[model samples]
Target chain A: MAEGSFQYITLAASLPHLGALFSNADLPMSRYRLEERLSMLEDEDRRRLDRIAHVTSWPGVDGCDTDAEVVARFEAASRSVQAHPDLAAVVRERLETRMLVAALRLRRDGAADPAPVAAWGRTAIARAIRTNWSEPTFGLGRARPWLRAARALCAAGDHIGLERAVLTEVYRQIDRAADDHQFDFEAVAFFVMRFQLIERWQRYDATRARGRLEALLQSTLAGAWTAGNATPTGAGMAGSLSQ
Target chain B: MTDLVLVLGWFGLFAPVALGAIGSSIGCARAGSAAIGAMLDTETGYGRFIGASLMPSSQVIYGIVIMFSLQRDPMTAEAAAGVFGVGVLAGVALLYVGIRQGEVLASAIVAAKAKPEIFGISLAPAAVLEGFAVFALVFALVLSGSIPG
Candidate 1:
């Protein structure tokens, strides 16, 4: 639908509430069903939404062979979502967030400076990160408060904590955009983005992790199952990975 | 001036019904769309949603009543003034209330769908809007009695 013609009361109302982040263990609706509902959108709108998703979701950039390719795809996606101001803001924040988190990870991994990380982020932040390489928040802590806590999480060797903090910040950004819209394309786009986050969170469930481990075990261990498998494994890889 | 007053008399005579219809239609359509959308997500309680969507229709009913109360057997300059004042003002009130009522009802429906327990309390705002429309209707009828027929 056109921007102003988006009377999506029915469309938005049809979708169930996604509640707070990490509040629900499972998605209110499945990806397939959500896609079916979203098919009601015009082709142009759907394409715009896809572009927005490409910038924010991991799978959107999964096929890129190099960082430059990813950056190029991100630029294109950012342009496509410009028509939606709220969503444009969301895309912008997501990019900055990804840059900030990546910088954190690289620094944690013993990168000496932000010079290499500067190649992929915005111009404004490239200078800040590069100049503040020795600073804990890279001198943008006040502007980006989440970065301070995120930096602390990285230093404390809490990768899972860092992941949680990053996801929460991203979720809040989308949630803020969502508050301005109720029955429009922006609402749908925000809903889909939040759904992706919820799905990712659910995938971090212990049951799902156990299932994945079993599948891997069946392949590598040749389906071997000892009776001791029923006993406590003392916090296996699945335990730490479960959200 | 007399002819203009007579023309306004006719305009005022029909204003309530016409304006009310406009308001009701807008309100009903807004809430009705929300109700339909809510139905897709829900299995039961369709009746309540449909019923809530009809809340805006009362604006038209009040408009019709105002029209009847403002009716004069033979339009005159003196009666024309009161008719125009009461009927037009009443119509404007209904129109505004109807549109606002629709918006609130739509919000109520959406909120209630998320939390069903709030459905009853959610209608409170729309009900209060109905009270305002009734106030316009009641006073217009009272004032219509004083017009020089």
Candidate 2:
């Protein structure tokens, strides 16, 4: 009967169900529609949702210069959303999942030992990764069944597969949290998080990225040749550089 | 003492209607909000959602019936206790069932919006709750017959 509960129920009901990850290539709802529904959230809850999104979403962390900086942002964001324990756990779980993937990547890159727990700031997951660095799944295959597939994908250098597997796991995590919340702030957060994954996955186009990369390489080579030929005019190489 | 008893008798006579109305209002509000929200997400079936939300409104009508059933010739201390017990308890049942029905109906509306095929079946739980409200109503009516006029 409280005002906030009514608003949450409305917001929740307005959101169309996002089916299982990869079930739909297109998003169930548009960003504009989602933001409009989200407008009903209380100011404080809205702030928390923003913080959580910034810490977890790709666009939110685009400016971070280092892994440690990303972890610091996650910590702050997670702390801000502490009022919702499920969402808070979600933030932590996301950070740990990413850290685990990073660990797997490190192993694939020929690292002799696991990265220190300080960088990842997930002591439990980090320690597991450290102790089971030689193990294919980092000894977490039981709980996180996707770990084995993720490790295999990392080993095979299947960036796309790894991305899909990791996103699927993250999506599953958000989905699990959603089971406990229907018409509350936590439910809204879970909905937004899952929507983000769906949007991100739909946006992913490996072929387009590869094409763009090749075009950039050609342009850079052409710029280098032009700079080399400009020697007749006594132009400095640095000056002739296209960048 | 007799005056207090007479006042209680009158309070009992109207309690079912008052309490049931409160419950129905809250239940209908909860379900109706969900229905309105679902309407924003779907293209059709607005009527079904609205109908589902009205399911809780039956509580108020049941309350009214109980009010009529518990009506006696005149307010008397002898029958005050019996009427109070039956009227208040029935009202409480209606109130509780009404609110719970609203919660379930809201959930049902939201779910049925997602998978339209389940709309009819999703209402089973709410129907069960309506059965509970009827139980309270029928029993209150049957019990009212035994109260001394």
Best by DockQ: 2
The alpha-carbon lDDT assigned to residue A109 of candidate 1 equals: 89
TM-score, cand. 1 vs. native: 0.87
CAPRI verdict (incorrect, acceptable, medium, high) for model 2: medium
User: How many residue-pair clashes does candidate 1 contain?
Assistant: 0
The per-residue C-alpha lDDT of model 2 at residue A224 equals: 62
DockQ of 2: 0.59
Chain A TM-score values, per prediction: 0.83, 0.81
Measured with C-alpha atoms, the lDDT of residue A74 in candidate 2 is 86
Top candidate, metric lDDT: 2
- Give lDDT per model, in order: 0.84, 0.86
Which digits, one per residue and each the tens of the lDDT, describe model 2 over residues A124-229? 8877887888888888899988998998999999998999999999998888888978888888888888888888777776466777777776766666677668
For model 1, residues A12-92, the per-residue Cα lDDT tens digits are 878898898878557777889888888888888888888787667878878878666676777777778777778877887
Q: How well is each residue in B46-141 modelled by candidate 2, as lDDT tens digits?
A: 999999999999998999999988888786788887788898899889889888988999999999999999999999999999998999999999
Candidate 2 residue pairs in backbone clash: none
Candidate 2 positional error at A221, Å: 16
